[model samples]
Target: MERDAVIVAGFGYRRGASASSLHAALALAQAGHAQVTALAAPGDKIALLARVAETLGLPLFAVPLSALGATTTSTQSPASLAARGTGSVAEAAALAAAGAGARLLAVRHISPDRMATCAIAEGPDR
Candidate 1:
């Protein structure tokens, strides 16, 4: 496998998202392109993104979701959510390291207001 990167963003469960972003993500995933998710997305969004990755057998690079700006009811990260309430954060991290057939990394995003949230915005493996 050549191993490509994928980023999905601008996902709003209640508000919805731009057609372009979704289309672009799907196209990129289908074409096997590297990506970095840099949107004001939430934790549930990350979980959904992970499910998409699992379905397509594609590795997803996603942000470390938090409750600071989220409006949903989730209190867990994607890794924790994926483990189905059976693994700790450390174990999940270990699994990500060992069984992670794909690479995922966290990158900092510069806001328009020049503020830093130290968020785990998704990025490509490139």
Candidate 2:
């Protein structure tokens, strides 16, 4: 892993999802990938993501709803589109929090329980 690289892991989870669910999703998305420097999620989900960030010893970025809705994602989900006006919550959050010129390392990954999703993004500077 490049220590200087800025890699962000974004997550989206259903209400009542356990911390393990988010961790599982993140682990799946991060397998064989660079180390995650940060975590992000929609503003409404920030509190939930913050717990994971704290456990991982990483900062958490709270992406605005408008920004999340505006971001384009590699994977499209009808449920996410209808609820958040984005294709994928995890992907949108990752890109939005990664700042301008960010790109996804891969498509979003879901937890085994199917209650959470995660996506990784790297900033342009990386």
Candidate 3:
């Protein structure tokens, strides 16, 4: 049976973050995978995600915050927990957006500016 590919990159950023920050983070995360089929982020970060999606020429998805908390990540950040009820927004968003039977292809990676972070997730073969 042929299986469809489902790879996504999820991002988290602070307000006023620049596209360069997101690009850096995405680049780092993509090192683990050759390509990313889509991009995703928390619902409130639609504008930021859109900018990143435009820059990368990929589709963007808004992951509901309610779905974020249940995701397990390789790293944990206190600040992220306080802000979004998740240990790592990038990881959580990636898993949430990828839907059930998803796994992290890349752990969270932060940009040099510390303004943005990204992670990659791959859904079960479908």
Best by lDDT: 2
Q: Candidate 3 local accuracy as lDDT?
A: 0.88
lDDT of 1: 0.33
TM-score order of candidates, top first: 2, 3, 1
TM-score: which candidate is best?
2
lDDT of 3 at 36: 90
For all predicted structures, in order, the TM-scores are 0.26, 0.94, 0.92
Model 3 Cα shift for residue 7 (angstroms) = 0.8
Candidate number that wins on TM-score, 1 or 3? 3
- State the C-alpha lDDT per candidate: 0.33, 0.90, 0.88
- lDDT tens digits, residues 8-110, model 3? 8999899988989999999988984859988999998879779779877888889888888888877799999998889999999998888898989998999
Q: Write down the lDDT that model 2 would get.
A: 0.90
Report the candidate with higher lDDT, 1 versus 3.
3
Off by over 4 Å in 2: 1-3
Taking the candidates one at a time, how many backbone clashes does each contain? 0, 0, 0
> In model 3, where do residues sit more than 4 Å from their true spots?
1-3
